[model samples]
Target: CTIGFGSKAKNIVNEDMVLAKVLRSQGAIPLVKGNLSLGCLSYHSSNIIWGEAKNPWNHDRSCGGSSGGDAGILAAGLAPFSIGGDLVGSLRVPGAFCGVIGYLPTPARNSVIGCLFPTETDTLNSE
Candidate 1:
């Protein structure tokens, strides 16, 4: 149940988990994916794929896709925090490129119910 990167996770957003941290910290669930949409985020839903982050510093090039919006918002100081998914470098790539702190939790530690499914299985495997 993985929504491949690039144009797949293009514009899907869901309600933030009310108890994501509580559930995870208690081990009820390993991880949670929220807050980031390549085209939207908790702070905004601009449906902008190419517009992406303003680079916060660069203002040139894109912050990446699918989760690009989230990365940009976070990096640009729009919000102090955010959550996002990364199937093919959405989180890490833009994070590095935007010069922001992005954390791709340890394997089996986070559960991506939307973009990727079967939280019990790893979706990062290469085809």
Candidate 2:
């Protein structure tokens, strides 16, 4: 299991996130970090560190975002699974573009990662 660099914890050693811990307990190894969107809300995946994540199918196209790297890695068979967050289609968009399944767990269901968005705003939405 690997996490997206864009969402990694800002620690000296880059400590694992909750989801990573769970996966580790299950004997999964944390390998690498994938690239993700700017500020994780731009609906596109790219960064100064890792550069842009291009679509495996068509290099000219984007892999979609925030979770774009997650989908791309899976589509390319680079890993069994990559951790990512899906707020406002972050996961779905990339999954669709990469032709992989991107799932958004029910809010607070698994507590995988902290919401990057401000918590003052309610996350529930009918749209």
Candidate 3:
């Protein structure tokens, strides 16, 4: 049961991303460019990069931003596994709130992998 959320939610970032590779291999879909997403145009948010992500655990609490939609789906149990990018705490923040794994794969050192199998270890490892 996959679900998505946001005000101006675009499928490219969330829903489509989940199936992009498979769809591409099948030639059933076209490649779409990801948004630079320089910033959010929301006036209601003080953060200014789109409003804060709504915490399903407690709607008044923040989920995370930039990748809020991804977090929301995860928090709500919309999907078993999901993908989200991290320029900041976008991934970690939601994972903490939703009780799931969040990864930050680094491209250095011949591809740095992280959070793929997040454990209490991640919390202890962070410095």
The numbered model that scores best in TM-score is 2
Off by over 4 Å in 3: 1-19, 22-52, 106-127
TM-score of each: 0.51, 0.76, 0.45
| Residue 73 Cα positional deviation in candidate 1, in Å, after optimal superposition | 1.3
Q: What does candidate 1's lDDT look like per residue over 1-127, in tens digits? A: 1233355545555643433554557766433332334333222222433333455666666665445556677777766655555555656666776677777765656544433333333332212
- Residue lDDT tens for model 2, 80-117: 87766565787789999899988765665554343244
- The per-residue C-alpha lDDT of model 1 at residue 99 equals 74
Model 2 lDDT, full chain set? 0.70
Question: Please, what are the lDDT tens digits per residue for candidate 3 over residues 62-88?
Answer: 555444555566667765555544545
**Which residue runs does candidate 1 get wrong by more than 4 Å?**
1-51, 114-127
Q: What global local distance difference test value does model 1 have?
A: 0.50
Better of 2 and 3 by lDDT: 2
Number of the candidate with higher TM-score, 2 or 3? 2
For model 2, what is the error of residue 81's alpha carbon versus the real structure, in angstroms, after optimal superposition?
1.5
lDDT-better candidate, 1 vs 3? 1
Q: Rank the candidates by lDDT, best first.
A: 2, 1, 3
Select the stronger candidate by TM-score from 1 and 2.
2
- Quote model 1's TM-score: 0.51
Q: How many clashing pairs does model 2 include?
A: 0
